[model samples]
Target: MQPETIKTQQPDLTGAAPAARLHQVAAFAGLSADQTAHLAQPSNIERSIADHMIENMVTTLAIPVGVATGLLVDGQEVMVPLAIEETSIVSFVTDSARKCRPAGGITTSMSGTVMIAQIQLVHVPDPYRTRTLILERRDEIGALCDACDPTLLRMGGGFRDIEVRIIDTAAGPMVVLHLLIDTRDAMGANTVNTMAEAVAPRLKEWTGAQPLLRILSNLADRRLARAHATWRPADIGGEAVRDAIVLAYRFADADPYRATTNNKGIMNGISAVVLATGNDTRAVEAGAHAYAARSGRYRSLSQWEVDAEGNLCGSIELPMAVGLVGGATRTHPTARVLLAITGAKTAEGLARIIAAVGLVQNFGALHALTTDGIQKGHMARHASNVAIDAGAVGEDVAQVAQEMIARRSINVETAKAILAERQSQRAD
Candidate 1:
């Protein structure tokens, strides 16, 4: 399929064009006038809802929501709405991807998503003895587990393998059964958890190993997605800059403390999309960090190297267990809209896009660290926000923001002062 194109997302201010013309485009399709207005300005309000057999429950929380503009994935133009609060996140990723767009953006590939369901079996007289029984009846047990979610089987996904581990822990010797499940497109949590519960009773009877916990493990090492991108040396010129990036990457690669911050840069973008979709961002984050240290040493989630051709090549590999069928994927209207814009039908496809976002975002940070420094480009974008917060009106917003950034004081107070000075000059 051809890639999408990026277009200016500014609302139609002029009353000249036919309204239907805008609706025909994919960008404006499937949205009501009211929803369109809501997108133009999002709100975070406290609301109450009744749960089954439960009375009035009120929740107070701030939704860190915003929009990610200028997204061009595979020639498709999408204006993504992100609900995230972490500073410098959305800006860094979007800016990096824009610079790499000329090189055909970033291309991503993913492995077939296979999430592991850990069914803990404990209090057994002999875990080693139980291991033999489970393995011997692997297919039979796997079928019993798969039968719980027939819909998944009909969709060509279900329990694929069964393995048992005899772990000697501080508490005692225990057997941990692993159900390697193929979740297909959806996040495999509910499916695997259900399967685990179904097999628990059978497992207890067969091996006499009591089932303790039947839950899905967030350490999604099996379901992995990766993305890669390359930037020409000419695009990011000078030997000094190249060396600086390589050095910075090495610092991150070698030290866990540095690597954590560097990886956080990548997650800033990935988590935004994940949050927008109503997926579990915390699970994704946990899986990523755990996967990074899977080899016994904590390191950078991304790898950076200067290729023989002198072009900068970057890649990232992370555990991404995202889904499409369950949770807020269908519940929230905005998530539904964002999913449609990406043209992703399956959960794995979304994982690939998330991987690509991380790659582009990390590149953004490394590029900044190597060249003019991380604050320059980020502060420039933030200046406008400060200006607005300082109550700069209309055209003066941009003008005053530019002056604040130029003076190296891109803060709300500086912006306010600049706006007042500009107004006084105009009055004089």
Candidate 2:
């Protein structure tokens, strides 16, 4: 028997009622026809056929990835697509965005893309000789690299600067070449790596420096993006709220133990979208934490300050290297759909949206910790899963889950209790 060939389909938006178009995902099932059409617009429908190898390599499982709605980014309403299974992440970001809505939402900006390429030079007769040789030949070397990617140059993007370093490592004394390239709108990793590899032969001929590693580095400190928001004192008014928020930031900043977890809260939303859309989450994480410790200390990813007017101001700056085209973004079916949803023009535009989502996520955690407590809200959403696991069906799943939470017990034990109680009453 031939297995079904699952062709990717969009909710048909051609004159269909709005609620009728949200096809695959259950989360969007309740949306109106207008909402479905808006979501299913041609701009948001991205499709790609998976090569058999690609399907075999990455993962065989398809996890539920949903868009976090009610987001107002840069005064624009957005539905953020997040590809993660963890409970509370989507809800947390949505809650945070709602809190920030009155403050005009989040504003973000990115440094124009500057990517790094690393070249390792080994077995040099004299380390200083190779360093001087490379520096002297920089313009020639840069020109050679620039020629390899003419399209980038035509678009006002190409090699901008060259740097060299001599390091004494456990292996031996080695010289390194650093190529700084302005990538413009795309994630410059592939661009920079190609240019670096193109120059390796020339570099060998000049100084006899054996190039070992010709690759792009993820430490995109030069390509940083930042987002900031402010909350009124009246909005956070009570002493407990103020103290708890400040304490949360301080704890993360003061202790590396806490900072990683704190940053994880921010990445919960950021990474989900990154993974769903086929962006390199590992590279982004590596660059982010490395940049965080560039000052020689592992500190918090965000800073919190109280203004003279007593408003709580928060800001975050981190290395974010993301692209809208090429690599996984173009290859994956859903990743393409995610970019279509945003209608973003450039990679930097997407980065700003990502930063905004991170800020919103942080706000959600801080707000919960400062007020009602994180577990209270998180457990509420988690209850449904517990009910389902406990064998509750359809509507009864939510009912049993809510009842369990209302009684301050939302565990397997509680779920079982509710199930038994309901079954007994029905039997009577």
Candidate 3:
């Protein structure tokens, strides 16, 4: 599962046939011929390995894996795999990544791989006294949490600290206990949940209060990853475009409605990478949205600014609770290969790369939004899908799409008209 140990020379999938690309990546990763074929066939019987990974004995659900090229992160060229069903995301991020590559690519910073477990204590009589008692018993609570998993200890990660918070609500005053654990290369849901359960009885014992909701917090504020990129104004169509992008950011910054969509644009890139790398998208999304409103107002996750030299600068900081170990990240054929292709050395590196992708994606979106428009390039890119939808197969797909474009109308109705005429001419 350590992609850093991939000693074989990497494969360049440029111009490879789509149908054959899966096996090509498998071979590049030094898998056996059987594993290579397994990558292509979801019904290979090998993928649905019964009862171990999941339930109901169903087959694997597959999504088209598209690569966003030209990303130079941390001085290393990376091909990011996106598992999203949306159009223009891969193209947009790729566009920005290429534009900023000459200016030293992207620099990133990540906080610790710590996850939080919450022990909710209800019906506390003396809240202040209970808080003091809980703080004094920090070692006992931390020791009980650390004992929940032996393997987590072997990985050089274990319980770190405990925090107590007293909240007053309509129901009454309640004391909350927070357990911080370094789960190390794991998404840490199960690990932190186990610790919370293990320490729950003691938590109830010490405070003479009811312990409920022993679980990990999805608002992973502690495990944050950040990325920044700078692009010269001339390189990105001069000062007007730069200021326009900043204005585009201002619109989002000022309005919650615009900010949600703006942040969704960034998550379009982050979520795809998360899905591709086999992380929990729902948890990541929850944390991201919660982190967005941490300042009491929802706003964009990224900021656009002009540097002293008039170069456009963009930065993004968000919760990235991704991991390299366990779950589908290690077992899923495509996910494992994507990690290798990404060439990230650690979980932090993986997180940094994802954050950088988000920043670049936002840049492309704003750049397009402030200039021509989003749909001009996006619709043109996806017109072939519309052509296919209109029942234009094979040779006629491109033909119908081209005609639709020529007519300046790229939709189902337009595509169908082009196909019908083309078919009539063929019959004639």
Best by lDDT: 3
Candidates by lDDT, descending order: 3, 2, 1
Regions of candidate 2 where Cα sits further than 4 Å from its true position: 1-48, 52-59, 237-240, 424-428
Q: Write one digit per residue (lDDT tens) for candidate 3, span 242-355.
A: 999999999998899999999999999999999998888898899999998999999889999988888899999998889999787886666776777677768888999999
Across residues 18-91, which tens digit of lDDT does each residue of candidate 2 receive? Answer: 34424533233344445455456544333234444265443245556666665666656566678787888887
Best by TM-score: 3
State the C-alpha lDDT per candidate.
0.76, 0.77, 0.84
What are the runs in model 3 whose C-alpha is more than 4 Å off? 1-16, 19-36, 42-47, 50-60
What C-alpha lDDT does candidate 1 achieve relative to the native structure?
0.76
RMSD of 2: 8.5
- What are the per-residue Cα lDDT tens digits for candidate 1 across 64-143? 55444444555544444456765567666666666665555677778778888888887888878789999999989878
TM-score of each: 0.84, 0.85, 0.92
Candidate 1 at 396: error in angstroms?
A: 5.9
Judged by lDDT relative to the true structure, which candidate is superior, 1 or 3? Answer: 3
